[model samples]
Target: MKKFSYFLAVMFLFTAFAPAAMASAPEKSNKEDKELTPEQEERLEEIKSRVDEIKSMDFSSMSKAEIKDVKKELRGINKETKAMGQGVYLSVGAIIIILLILILLT
Candidate 1:
């Protein structure tokens, strides 16, 4: 009886852990891009703010290099914003389509 009770307890423990060990995480969508690290995100925000400040300045009398630098900063901000914007667009589009399908089905 002692040996049989130990076997049952060990069996219960293994069963409880087995499924979790074998289960897989769901895969991300192909439309999704790699996310930036926390540090990268903060830097990106800083870059955007700097670009906005530069744009708000009057550039009429600026030299070629100054205009070029401002343009470069603006492009960098646009690229980062576009990349971040893509994920949001995909998510909102998916939600809207799902809602439309549900409306049609009902």
Candidate 2:
């Protein structure tokens, strides 16, 4: 039980300091934002306008089918936006596994 408590304390300290250490590290070149092409920018602007139009619409008066169509359109837009963005996305499970690996290695 004492060893378990000590292990927990060490884990807590490690997790707390890990972010600080990472923050102090130099930023990678990939972290720099890339300039969007003219076509991409125009498409993004169109997407924004469409989203605004959807937001301003009265959903209560719309038919169920129309609402479902609108939702489908929004999902497509979400996929497009995600595809346009560049980043590494880690799921909760992956993050937990990474932390476990670090703890075990230490």
Candidate 3:
């Protein structure tokens, strides 16, 4: 019957396209932080080295004002790390918003 043939065609198309859709998606990692890009790894290493260098210094010889300045510098480094990650989040957000607007307009 024509109805049976039409049903088969629809089922065949669905099965064929389903795997293609799934294949295009990337697999998510359980621990995203476990993977780091080269630049991120480099930054992490620099921060670690800076902390080690600061730890090796003799605080007894430095004046109180000098230690306060060092603490402020460490806080600044922490802020830099936070700022670096936020740019990616902001761009992704902007893209999603743009997509929603386009979808609604259509």
Candidate 4:
């Protein structure tokens, strides 16, 4: 019984500290932050702000399911932005083609 209790205590410590320790370890950069363009900086700031909000969130009183929803929301925002860029490219091409046809007709 004593051995089992000790094992449970160690297991609890690992479960609590492992993720926090790993999260603090810095990831290696394939690119420099200063070299990033304005658009890239803006996107990074937007994501950082969102994650900050999520981190400040009171997880002490919430369930795991709610945390999952927050991740899903962030992913959805990224997908929407990518689609909007594609739409903008399509619109620009169509406008150029229309202008060329109008010039030819006149």
Highest-scoring model, TM-score? 2
Residue 43 CA error for candidate 4 (Å)?
0.8
Clashes of each: 0, 0, 0, 0
Global fold similarity of model 3 (TM-score)? 0.42
Model 2: lDDT to the true structure: 0.80
Question: Which is superior by lDDT, 1 or 2?
Answer: 2
Q: What lDDT score goes with residue 88 in model 4?
A: 24
Full-model lDDT for every candidate: 0.68, 0.80, 0.71, 0.65
Model 4, position 46: C-alpha lDDT score = 84
- TM-score of every candidate relative to the true structure: 0.39, 0.56, 0.42, 0.34
For model 4, how does the per-residue alpha-carbon lDDT over 13-54 read when each residue is reduced to its tens digit? 665776677679997742323355677658767866886898
Off by over 4 Å in 2: 1-18, 21-32, 86-106
Per-residue error for 101 in candidate 2, Å, reads: 32
- Arrange candidates, best lDDT first: 2, 3, 1, 4
Clashing pairs in 2: none
Candidate 1 lDDT over residue span 21-106, tens digit each: 54665555544566777877887778767867886898899999999987887777778767664323444335545765786699
Consecutive 10-residue window with the lowest summed lDDT within model 4 = 84-93
Model 4 error, position 99 (Å): 64
Clashes of 2: 0
- For candidate 3, what is the lDDT? 0.71
Which window of ten consecutive residues has the lowest lDDT sum in model 2?
86-95
Specify the highest-lDDT model's number. 2
